[model samples]
Target: MDKVKFGVLGCARVFERRMAPALKSAGNAVLHAVASRSLEKAQATAGKHGAAKAYGSYDALLADTDIEAVYIPLPNDQHAEWTVKALAAGKHVLCDKPLALSVSEAEWMAGAAAASGLRLMEGFMYRHHPQHKKVFEVLRSGAIGEPVHFRGIFTYPATADHAGIRWNPAQGGGAFLDVGVYPLNAARWLLESEPTEAKAIAITDPTSGVDSHTAALLAFPNNRTASLIGGFDQAFTSRYELVGREGSITVERAFQVGESGVRVLVRANNSDTEEAFFFEHTDQFQLEVEHFAACIRNSELSLEPGEDGVAQARAQALVLSSL
Candidate 1:
């Protein structure tokens, strides 16, 4: 396929503001269709995104033979069900983060994808950003010399609307499932190991019955450890610091690297000097879309494959259980 045709499974705000533009920017992909429960909304979104078709239901979009892949930005609880359905319909899937609410569901989705011989990937746009690659390169260069600890914070004030999906517990609303996964995934990626133990403390909202704030601790092998804070009712902050034997590295605005330049700060052991590494901004979502399209064209798995989603969900389940 010269260009992989994509069908968006929802007209969610994230799709309108981010993924739609990303699809337009991706070199090897096209925004071919969109679907929503409401036909008018679907048509409006399709018009805005330049999709050729719009459907009143997700099933209709899945049935469209022209759509070779589906980008699912549905609620966290809906990811596995729709991903399995899309795979059954012969469409590769790029599901938004928290690929499933549970490890079992993630494993089931992965199994379905494998059975259908289709590619399935979780949408972690930050991993595709050039800044993260730079960080990895710096780490590999021994600039941070054997990282021993990671501290990450991702938090933002929640809207007053208690009816919002993000604040609705029945719909899989919570801080941990939303933004907490980023820091946890970062810790695992940077350490190149899964956490051996995990624990978390959460503050549940009185009215919403969902966790409004959470702090988690993960212990990896080699005596390495990580502390992560995520909250839905807090001042806006997103950053991380990796401490090593020789030095430390800090990333500001870590999760949402937007289109502006970002900086990484490095400090050597016993040195007051802090060096800054700047990275020109790029569209990470576009890169993510292009990479998925490439994997589909080449008949290979994505860099963040379905199994990775399962691993993430497993760790998440462990933490949630502990909480």
Candidate 2:
């Protein structure tokens, strides 16, 4: 099968720093084109990444018949609009996480993909990392008994000025929308269930009106629970724990494990020493792109898909409502 020809929809920092390089390395995909609001920037990005085509605007890239799939790393607010446009142009889509600011927008994006019979996946790159698979394997082996509780943390001290697009609510920037969704998705993934109830609290910055920190508790079925915290008001950490009846498991450097070794720790109830699982660094973004390409090329290949994105937005909406 031919590699999926991917057209990048924006010059987002994530693209330049991560996804562009990942797409270039993916065995099942090619970085065919790149577009930006500025043609000069687009040209520079294409030259830097060795993309074959560059367009002044996203619409131009979508209009290009050669691009078989599109990767959108746009601002949160722009995801739905560009996604629908790309699908309408008969291309599969892989949009960045927190798929949209609201569930309605996510549904619309999903609906467009269904109407066109195109593959649509949310770009939760970390899920493709091998460390997470190890976590699940440990759980299945009963190292962690019947899963009962989850604690997820993803936070960092903002090194940049506090006045960027992240501080703007209209741009769909906030602690929960940005990094908090990772824990939310992780809980749903590991628990294999959805929440029945939710509660949350957030500390909003006065000048920005965006929550600098958000903490939430979600109650899942069968007495399972997850407590999550995400923000720029704390030291850098990306980790999560799953506590079962007999023991607990912890994943270190969980979400941001780019090109670095990762660890998972397991502690039994009466253990003097804890067991450990280690994984060597791997490019999760390349794995994610390859998976998306496989999904595009065959109906049998599973995808994270649009409905998952919609559910993620729905859960985020619940947390926002509680705040």
Candidate 2 lDDT by residue in tens digits, 109-153: 988988998998998898899888888887888866899999999
* Clash count, one per candidate: 0, 0
Q: What is the lDDT of residue 24 in candidate 1?
A: 94
For candidate 1, write residues 1-323 as lDDT tens digits: 58999999999888989899999988999999999999999999999889999999999999999999999999988998899999999999999998989888999998998899888899988888777777887788887788999998889997856878888887788888888888988888888888989889999989888898999999999999999988988998889999999888889978888567899888876477899889888888898999989988886454553358888888888789888
Candidate 2 overall lDDT versus native: 0.88
Off by over 4 Å in 1: 300-302
lDDT of each: 0.88, 0.88
Per-model TM-score, in order, reads 0.97, 0.97
What does the lDDT read for residue 115 in candidate 2?
91
Model 2 residue runs over 4 Å out of place are: 160-163
